[model samples]
Target: MHISAREREIINLLLDHPDGINVQEIAESLNVSSRTVQRELKGVESIASAHSLFLKKVLGVGMYIEGTPEQKNELQIAILKSGQEFTQKERQELILCSLLKEPESIKLSSLANDLHVTVATVSNDLNKVEEWLKDFDLNLIRKKGYGIALLGSERKKRKALGHLIAQQLNEYEFLSVVEDEYESKTRFSNGLLEIIKLEKLTMIGKMIRDIEQQLPYSLADSAFMTFTIHLSLAIERIIQGEVIQIDQEVLEELSISKEFIIASQIVIELEEVFQVNIPIAEKGYITMHLLGARQRQEKNDWQKESSTEMVVGSKKLINYVSKELEINFEEDQALFEGLITHIEPAIYRIQKKLDANNPLAGQIQEDYPAMFKIIQEGLSEAFPKIVFPTEEIAYLVLHFGSSQVIYDNSKEVRALVLCSSGIGSSKMLASRIKKEIKEITEIEVSSLANLRNIQIDQYDIILSTVEMPGFSKKYITVNPLLPKKEAEQIRDEIKRNSLTTEATLLRKLHNKKFKKQIKLKTPKLIKQNLEVIQQYTETVLHILNTFETISLPFIPTSSILLLEVCKQANVRGLIGDYFEVTNQLTEREKKGGLGIPGTSIALYHCRSEYVMQPVFLSFLLHEPMVVKAMDHSSIKINTLLLLLAPVDMQTGQLEVLSTISSTIIDDEESTRIFTSNNYTDIYSKLSYALYDNLQKRFKD
Candidate 1:
């Protein structure tokens, strides 16, 4: 007969009150919700029945165990021998939570009395708790006669509390609790929810979701959870008269950030909702969290100065890792973009001393020890002043590991990776599927916040690493590692749903239930399919018809070269105004290097109002000219590809233009043909590529 800590607490409480005890009293005694107490009572009744005792309850009254003294004594003995039913780690966490919640010193004897343990055991646990505090720059104080107290600034204390709460739940559980999707009755989760005030949490989560639209980029799930908790704790502590302090100087520095404006708006709303005046320092702290938060997608308005630094640092890191592993990664455009996106916010967190808190760092270390070591070395060499924690390094390894996964476009199926998984975990899972699952040729990652906006039918299958409580679309849940059994299950799923199988097609055609419907819809379906094909064909023909290679006079500088290309575009009736298009391209080029590294080409691209439509043109330089490459290194380029699209371009048109850009560098044969300066070969190659893409779309 195993008794949980809560159940044992209930029995002890009932024994003390032999007259009667109600659910409210038991809940208050255990510091849990009344609902939680009611749920735990089911197991308590079973325990009582096993002990030869009956729990009696009367309407509008109370309940108690009706049994002999010997039987009650037997139940007490079982509880005593059960030893409180808490592991060492659980006990330690509970003790830490107690210390964090208290403002003054707490005696060892008092802690032991509450946990049903001895003072000596608590004293030992305090040693480990003290070590954990040091990570947050906090200290534990103890004296001979006085009790123990945590010593730290209020800001550090709040940070420690938020981090402790986050550690108690994984990403899915945290989001579920915040969204009120379901109720989980675990001890830690329920306790933390109670402490934070669950109603307030739900309100704060909603407020943040409403405000997310004003943000430039989407917040990752982990970051969203962390920020929500931080705000909730801030409000709770503010009402309790325990306010944190930040230096005016530091606050002033933070006030210059774009996040500071958004934070101010949030604080204004908080003041209205809670009817309390939040301090200015609270807004500053909020800005700091926003600055240190991770984003799922890239923002176009990212600061140019910081982006330049990230570009330089990322290229160095990639070069170092590639050299150490003897693998060429410089040409991997996806890897380059991914590293920049991840490293930008990561450096912010590192500078702010915020922990990455990755859940899979240990597993990643075990799975790819060599790759981990090389990236660690690369980080140290690339950014000497910053120390990369194992957690951050593990995430970087996932990015590199994903870049190594070869995606075969010949495979037909597409999968969408939905969250409460973070970007790192999602990419690792996507990489696993690409490696083990032969049918999935493409994978798209999206967060739960953006799930409603996604075109659900575009993907052949949806894969998630978390439980979706009310999701309408059917999605398969798998572990991030995608073990062998899950791989086989995915294969079976794809096979069963496959439309290409002859037997399945025959069955669908011959089934009596569908014959009438198919006969009636065949004409309409044919018309719709024809319209779709025509739309795609029009885009393809427009791009190929406008694709031309021209020889340019000597242009010494990139600025002049861009002007010359725009002039040629004007002459070819591609743009309404050549000067406006030139300015747009030059402004974009100023943001970063447009040249593709290790190649004799520079990709100049822009979206402008002056452009008539999507256009792609190859310009051959009279002489090789020096240009800054994507890696910020000086390189000589003889060919420049200008890709332009209107601001209001359609999706299919933009995709067609993108296909043309990809064809230039997607393979060696395409790259050679584009750089060969042979107009006949270049035109034929692009026409065939576009035609093939259109044919594939029709087939699908």
Candidate 2:
């Protein structure tokens, strides 16, 4: 009795065009493929024939069936009838009776020819019909050339036919709308036949058929089946007046869609009409079933239902949410509301977001700053110092409040105590073990009976006096008397086992420093000259000394080379210039800012440490000094300042030099230092300030 959306559409086409509509025309009109039209028509044929309505296919054309109004009505009624008692022949006979006014009175040869059958077949059909109507005083009349006729009053015959039609329709009306193959194929293998077993599904399908006649195509068949399963279970509970535990997984899997929402609204309305308190999960299922059934009756009905206002509160909630999230509202509120209606689920999402932002937020503006801000802004005015949902807060307290054991790494490990049933002895054993094992994270004491069912995967380790099967691999056996030697061994084993792989990886570091080879040309002692260079070099050395130790691996080889160059420069009164360069380089390396500027340091090189040689260290300044060095197509340095120093020096030796350049560089600080009467005074002030600031800021 149940018809799919496409099947119903095809039937409607057939009913409107009694002359018959070809597959090509149907396909073209529906904007579907010819193959699709063919499939749809075939389904219609099966359903039509199942209901005792003859649908004859024309080879090069389409499908057709001719019937008077009475006959069509009768066929429609017969299709709705219950019981598997109607045979193919009986069905054909019913169709014929519905199609013809005086089927029994028609000549056998002519009637058989019109029906495309043999006279003998018609004669046999007449005989069966006569036997079926024996109580009505009807006899089969056979003429020499004409077909057999039923000799009965026209009024009596009409009454009998009407009664048969009503009986068939009454049974047909009760057939489940979801029983059809097209609607049930995705949900159940056997389709509607399998679904009918669920009492609620049967009722829901009937209700849908009576209301709309068919379901929509957009609502997939699987969705309908899922709805049936949930609704049926819920309806049964509701009828029995018992509260039911709805499965959360089922609701999630259903996935709220437009059809589902509409279906849910229908279910709610139905519940109001029936005065029942159906669970939300069950209501969802009923809605799907109804939508699917309605779709099967009329494909366009889905569009109408989708546009209709179903639930006001849900719609308002969706609108409110859309305003809050700044997202366009496209789906129905029912679908969206179903997602966040549960308090636990909503809280879980909030908690996850909090945890994800905890570390970064914790560092800024004290602990959990970002989390605090989000909670304050997002959750209105309920701001507690430790604000969290009840369950989450409880978990936090349980985790942090107790005086749990801490490992050497400061990690907490919750453990389980596997012991035999001896309350006093078990308590004493736990206390002793806790005292013996300095790093016991947690100790849960339980008897074997209770411990067997407990999930052991969560526990770090198990300590037991008794041997337990299945858990022997995870548990460490200990004597209940708490021997000191045994406890020490166990603790040592636990510590050894707990050592992480990262801790075990030994780094092979070479400590023997290699000295760089130097080639010198001068034979004079450059000690006094080197001492002068050392004073200038102090600025670079101070900066290097500030970052004396680095913990993280792999400082760039380029950075080390730059540091070496700065160390050799050691120019007096150039501390500010060097500080700026170093700061820029570090920032560029960290945040990829305006890259390291093209810069140069004038290093007055001093005397060599071991070799008897003269040394002059000079570095050319790279240009557009403030321009990021990384932006240059190529690095070029043309100017240089070289320093001359002695190879060796006695104690308290000093080397002083005067500028010889003809072109006076209009340098502010340099001009002041060069024009000053006392050079020591000028150098001392710059050196003191640079050293003081470097010590205070960079050192820390």
Candidate 3:
């Protein structure tokens, strides 16, 4: 019997506690949620059955193992002697690897036997595998007795194959294979490795490296590795007599391009090395890959691109998003450049029907649904003829999201950001690290290909978006978007390292001269610290004082209600002109919904030159008004939370205003207080929230 690592750990816990243990106790012990423990229990039950034992549950008592001591000991011994087995997810991937590589129908029983699982288990795995294939536009064909086959165009089949390999191996592992390490094969099992022989991978890698200098621009590490694997797989398929075809018209058009010439050269070399007759159509596909490949360019090199349409499209996108959000990004040059770099290849990928997979798509969508929708709308308006997938849209969101704010801090430590391609994710990750971590003074981004050439001692720390295999130096692997949990983790790690460095320095300076130097600067440091604290306190007070709840008379329409709020702000000197601010707010509303979902409140927020400072005001309506919710659904709202900030504001002030936005939808209690339209309750909530933030900023 095969059991996962988590299942073994769970069984061990149950064995230790022969007595009943509640689900909560199990969850606490494992450092997992109750839901995670509950989900694992279903798998745990199967292990118990295999060991001739049963789990006993009693009302209000919890669960315990019911079996003889001998049976328990035998099961424990088996677990101790057992090696790591294939997880259900790994098994499913192996199944996909087999199906994508196989050109003929494969039997269900054959798959079951190879995986050391039952036919029923394989069938269940196939159900999930089918859904995964659908993302590549491939279909799984299963018959009762005739067996199963995967049906798709050769182009899609190859796309699916490449994605599977990319998904299975991290950058480090992928590079290891290309370097002829073959270490990945030890863990990946036979099916995936059988797709391309190790020797072929090494040869392809060497050939690509030899020809790297011939190209007009250098390929990013991700693009280089992807192209290498693609060529290796194409050679393998060609050897097996699986020929692919390309459109003649497209081929004829591509033949005159520079990429086509390079593609032809690559095919000639491959034909010589593999001793196979390469077809003209193969060169056409290679040209497409080359056309869509991401090339490493300087940060300001976006203007160098030959495509004028791409530059115009990028400007239109930025203008659309700027108008909709009521923020000025027309002059954000970094944003314009990043969009040019991302959108150019994005358009080619879409035109070629390529799968631009984004692992962070779900997280990005969940975290910023409003921004996601806005970007989606902007894409439609900017590139009307092209239909971008969610994956590509998510990547574009990262580019815009990163450019939304700017952070300036007095950082002392230098860090390097190593991403797959130094493009969308790298820019976002670097921005987030600098924004959140004050100690990080400077950030430099590099592709994985440049890792070897980087001066390690120049950087105090190394941060990577992908895993680095065979790397001896210390590096923290972080997600591109920098989720909250990972941000905290990065903070803790930086702190720990800082303490170590400081301790060493203190030891080295354990003398009278060092002590005298520190004492000399004590008064100056104290005065500087006092000023910072006073500024923080003043900012906090200003934000809290500006926060107010006003009860407005009945307004029959949304537009009139907005004007009333703007007029109130103008009368209170919050804004210089109510008409201009109202116009800005109206434009924002037309772009997307501002209503908070699952509540009777709407949040109208904007950054405008008309606003004097950051303001958080609540307006209670005598009658509920119908508005659009964040999810694009109609909602009835009785409260309006107007959050405003100056067009040019300090990062600290922006943070406080952003905090208010978070607090409105933070949880049930805070949302309830805002929705209740109670002045004292809301004031207390903001006070507590700001207090917590102030503590972090002034923790020194």
Candidate 4:
């Protein structure tokens, strides 16, 4: 009988470890809970017995496979070829995954018949699948008479394929790390699971830990996952005797590098575990990846050994980059200082055939196309002798990108509004600040009389209507009414003070979080870290299910858009019209426009007394409607979602509600709100995934 992928891995691990390995050791290496290792132990023995072996376990000593080397190798070979069969959900995911990962286009009818579903159902499923494609800057295009194919960048395609494989082995962070309430996880594959196997993934995970120990830094989670997948693929090829060959010169160069040394160390462990001979040139492969993986800067320690040559390089790079982009960075001292610190270590790694690895290079290219393209072309000219890896190049792009932003608004900006004249003026000023500034998260108004009692240190900026000439603090003086010109003046003043910018704030926050300048509120600096929290929660409030979506005649104006969704939700008994949800949504629109920047989707959400329970309401226009965005740019909005929750709910509870809706409308999530031709498919794909993710996140 073919064993499950996970059980196969446990068996292989036991076989490799003749001296025996403990449950905890196995769990740590695999990045799984010890409880999972224990559960799999029961099945390992039964499978081992079939091959004339015993998976013997001692209470304190650990577990081992008792058999001759010949029997062990025979069992290992059988397990290598064996793999778990796909479930119905997995088959559907596999169909979609193959279309994206494979080079050739696939027929819709073929996929439907293979998955034992009708063509119509498969067609509907493609809608939800297409949503995932959008996130990678890819399009899942279907030719009328031909077949469907995923079109995008090669790197993005690989990343998507990596994610698909990760999902299959139940290695997904949401499914594995989180204690989700769901009975089963939906999985995907690209016809490689039987070849790659879960055992390889566990070994890959161990390999990553080993590499990390030798480095001065750590890779981002996405970067780490990408590396894990790369290593797994390498091992799979090794098993098939498809070893990679590196040029003699390149191999010699990489052999002396620290990254290659680490890679060599990893190979020793891998060779022992898998009992396969890894090619000598495989070290170069790992070395190249080490250079390609993105690095998150943990400190300014590079500043300590500040070398003059590095400073010169940073200056030349900054100058050429500024000229190429037609921007001013000559006088940005901190930018100079940061670049110098970045370059010293970067060059040290690059010279040794390794460069900093950045997993979000694709995102940087997508979001800042011009910047990335310009930097890519001009970097060689900027630093004549340097051969920068793609990851290092992207890192440089980030430095220049941050330098050009209007101002740094990274922290939760707090503004104390003071009016010497009256309380009303201060309140009015605070309201105008809220309307004008998206960056300022908190506003506190106080009269000059009570200003002494209010802690000035707590505030990032002090905005006063009446200037106190003798005031010892830096404050921006604004008109009481806070007109557009006056608001612009305040913004310019804030920009002039570069320390108050988002870049500066983020750097400070990152240091604090990393060094534990503040207490650790999380199990690790992941999921709950500032970057991660925002990353996951950015598209939280969106449409949830097909029932939540209502088709509308082409919306003409913002006023009508608000009325229709509230009315639709109210009619369905999902909400009641105190028009409080409507009023808040309209208020949001008036602040700017209803349209989300950079997309045709408009999101309107609020917590209101009018809300009975949490409800997600979506409206899609029959034809696109032009609406205003925050920047006053006209956006053709095709989709809109209204998320309403009870006013008294906790922020975490609100996040759960947002995440549920997001699973539907979010372009990244599996369950889509707008794509399915038949609405009922949304209920099945969404109802469980949405609830399950929420439960898992909450438990963690």
Can you list the residue pairs that collide in candidate 4?
Answer: 291-355, 292-357, 293-357, 293-358, 294-357, 294-358, 408-501, 408-502, 409-502, 410-502
lDDT tens digits, residue span 247-333, model 4: 799788767777787787887887888888888877677776776563536556555566777767777777766565334577777
lDDT per residue (tens digit) for residues 246-355 in model 2:
35765665446555666566677658755787667555444434433332235334234332222233244345433432333424332333322222222433432211
Number of the predicted model whose TM-score against the real structure is largest: 3
Candidate 3 accuracy as lDDT = 0.75
Model 1 Cα lDDT, one tens digit per residue, 1-700: 7888778778777766678877766766566666887888899899999999988886324688889987888787677666467646668888887777788999888989877789999999999999899988999999878999999887788778887777766778778877887443232433365458877878998999898898877887867887898899899889878888888988999999899999999999999999998999889888988888847454453334356778888999999976664456787878887788788888888877665656667767865565677789999888888888787899898887666321221135768886431222344466567768977777777656567777665566788755454455556676555668778878887765552222221232244356577667587887876776676678778877788889998777877888899999989998888888898777666544667665788877767789877778889999999887644567889998887877665546644664565566555787788787778998898888778877787787
Q: Which residue pairs show collisions in model 3?
A: none
* Per-candidate TM-score against the hidden true structure: 0.48, 0.17, 0.50, 0.37
Native-structure RMSD, model 4? 23.9
Q: When superposed on Cα atoms, how far off is each prediction in RMSD?
A: 29.6, 33.6, 21.8, 23.9
Per-residue C-alpha lDDT of model 3 across residues 458-572, encoded as one tens digit per residue: 5657887655544555576665546677777677766655422321222222432366776676888778766666655776798777778999998989999999999998888
Worst 10 residues of 3 by lDDT: 499-508
Best-first order by TM-score: 3, 1, 4, 2
Q: Which has the higher lDDT value, candidate number 2 or candidate number 4?
A: 4
- How far off is residue 264 in model 4, in Å? 2.6
| Each model's lDDT | 0.74, 0.41, 0.75, 0.62
**Candidate with better TM-score, 1 vs 4:** 1
